[model samples]
Target: MSLQVPRNGKVCVIGSGVAGLTFSYLLNQLRPDVHIDIYEKQERSGGWLNSHHREVNGSKVMLERGPRTLRGKSDGSIVMIDIMRRLGQLSQVQYVGKKSQANRQFLLNGQGRLVEVPKNWTQFAKFVMDPISGGLVRGMAHDLLHCKRLDRKTYEDESVGQLLARRFGSTEIGDRIISGIYHGIYAGDMNEMSSLHTGRRFVEDEMKYGSFVRGMFSGLGAKPSEILSGELMEYNRSIGGQTQHNWTEFARRVKQSAMLGFAGGLEQYPLALRAYLEKQQQVRLRLGQAVASVLPGTGQNVVVNGVHYDHVRSTLNPSAMAAIFPEIQGLQHGDFKSVSVYIMNVYVPGTNLIRDAIAGFGYLVPQRSSQGDGLLGVIFDSVVERNYLNWQTQLPRHQDDCTKMTLMVGGHYLNKGLHLDLHKCLGHVSNHLGVDLAAYNPVTQNLLARDGIPVFDVGFDKKAARVVEECTRLYAGHVTLGGVGFARGPGVPDVVMHELAAVLHA
Candidate 1:
């Protein structure tokens, strides 16, 4: 897949999110002679990564609209850490402590109360015996020992729910555990999403060894980042001389159980990337300009916005990309699925909440828990970053003592619409936390209207592969597709590795 791009070759990147910017940044560094143009339809270049800070009294209140932190175990974390070091912004990166990673998270039990997730064998046994988690734990155990072999000649796609039911004795495990975690990550429906695409490693493991447990045991010693990239070690080695060693140090840090974020916020990474690109003579950033369509140019060039380019990498969603290049197969409607989620930022009395709340990262609500309006989860921003709320307070009486949280809602409803009201979300949190916000005197609230999270449904493999092949053929090897929407895996690191591969292979 390696191609010798000509000197001074022109490459147009559509979208300036982490994926597009990372592609441009790495490409500029690798082939300094290449001309790059990054076009973003929105005025801001960071895509959905929005962070806001306000000064109350003398203290600072921070709110993250999207992607609060990057998991240390992910390849995306390693990539971002590497980029931070290269950009001279590593010092600005802050990591969450062991408590955030190692401590037990909560799940809303059938009794409408938060319950600590079991950690050790004793806790596991108790959790399994409890009525709330008994069925799920027993079902998962049954599958681990007696699941049937999934023999297939071609890539067979199935939903997380179907796979669990087929392999395990019951689909309760899927409806409870898988759905709870994935809903927060993808905002996807368990019955509709493709297990092959979303949980490929576990699925592939089961396919290879006839049991997912066996596959997990086989790779238990490997670093999570290696597993996340599906083994991109050789590709990393091909890019830079010290890539492997740098990644090794990152893996060590991950083992310490750290979830990383920018001191300012995730938005800083993209802002830094933009600033670096502006200094490059061959780089051009087109903000607030949308690409109407992409067409083929004469010979080997690709055409967009009436200009010819040697290569074009699209980080747009499947539907958006299909609208621009209608000729590409399998990018049409129904091939790709996305769900919109409403995010509410709430501020509660910090000192009391921190001392009284669950004190870990946050809590996830399983579908079986039967919560109102099907809320996905709530993130304890202040708890995750303990220093986020430490500052002087503006009010003479009220010091800087408020816990900040981001409430995520409406992931279960794919077709049905969800009516999101601030008071409603607050009411849910108030009841769940057993705290009355009215007593806090002044409660601050910010809302992120909507953001899309992609879903890979059954039969998505053939269609996704077809789309990639068609794009490559139509552009004559000049167009490479990548992003959270286009990649095999989810999250930031998967997309980073995807574009990294394109530039390296190119």
Candidate 2:
């Protein structure tokens, strides 16, 4: 039934980010009897999902300071739909269809020109001729012809750069393609990022099939059930049959779409979660209340800020966790690094600023082209959802003439100690888009020291494993990791999957 059901067990969830809130939401659903207390250091929920709403003249404009969209193809998107359907916020859901022009993603070439990433072999053949592809075609040939499997016994883990370099016979492919993707997503370095955590599938594929090319061919006939975890498959099944939610129908709606977002913005997702959790008598969201301490309590219970709980579910990063609970031996001063990103949300009304008015998702600044401006990427926020009317309102997302986008710059991974202010950064993006952004005044531009994007260095999975092993040895069963810090990736789906799995294990 509802989340208001009473329960005897008590649980504490730290950090009211996506992971903490989603964990609490799932907790009430699976075990409604357990009373939950969510602790957030910030004054609101939705961790980095901040949407700045502004009404200029007649049209409403939304600018995102953090994460903005969810890919429809990810299992996390389905999890979001399940939560949204329950929150009565499905009406706020928006879609970017697969065939939409906004789906075209670009990577900056060495000459600082935008080149559309090849979608097919015909395009790839043409694309590789350009120097920006970094001998991608030649690399693919090398992998197909000369690649050899790694020794499982010795190759426990490596950097994503190492993996790509090993297979492609050079680091060029990783530097050009994979680096940009990771930068855009994690604000991290491909050379330092863990292959065990990110490229494990490729590692396994190589070991099994000799190369990624052969691996891809071998997996051509795999079904959804085979690709997705049993837990996710079961969750989808459980929600699909729920006539009220009609998740099956919802999935059908977005399955063909490229990405999904909220009507106002992504902030709606976390706001909805907090609103729903607030209605439940069994849940308490302690926003603006930081957890000062976490220690082992009597029996199998853990104490959070002096309050005893049956279990402690932490969404805090490893460093934050180490600070709070020093007893966790292996968690001390993690090898992982944090990155500072400069996010500038630009909203220019009645003007299509893109070069030649090109309609696409936006271009990413890869490793080779990352310097000078520190522009990691640009999200064509308005362009991506073009032609898609507002949810039920049947109006364009913004004024027909308005264009919205976010510029990322000065990430520590690439430009450490680089503090390129919004003023200095405008010209770089302007040169790329062929617009004088310096002349147009915009809203919301600043540097955010976000802890959400954790830079997982090589051997991170091993370190994480050792931390878990130490926790199990030290705390017995009092503490559990669940959030961006512990998840395989910081994506919404990864967070939800890891947290829910921890709940089941706990």
Highest TM-score against the true fold, candidate: 2
Candidate 2 RMSD to the correct structure: 3.4
For candidate 1, the per-residue lDDT at 257 reads 46
The ten-residue window of minimal lDDT in model 2 covers 1-10
Per-prediction TM-score: 0.89, 0.91
Candidate 1 lDDT tens digits, 204-249: 8777887876775687666444443433464456543455666665
- RMSD per candidate (Å) reads 4.3, 3.4
lDDT of each: 0.73, 0.75
Report the C-alpha lDDT of model 2 over 348-413, residue by residue, as the tens digit: 777777753456888888887775666788887768656455444546564477678888876654
Off by over 4 Å in 2: 1-7, 57-59, 216-229, 236-249, 355-357, 387-399, 504-506
The collision pairs in model 1 are 57-394, 76-493, 350-401, 350-402, 350-403
**Runs in model 1 lying further than 4 Å from the true structure:** 1-4, 99-103, 152-155, 212-247, 355-357, 387-400, 412-414, 441-451
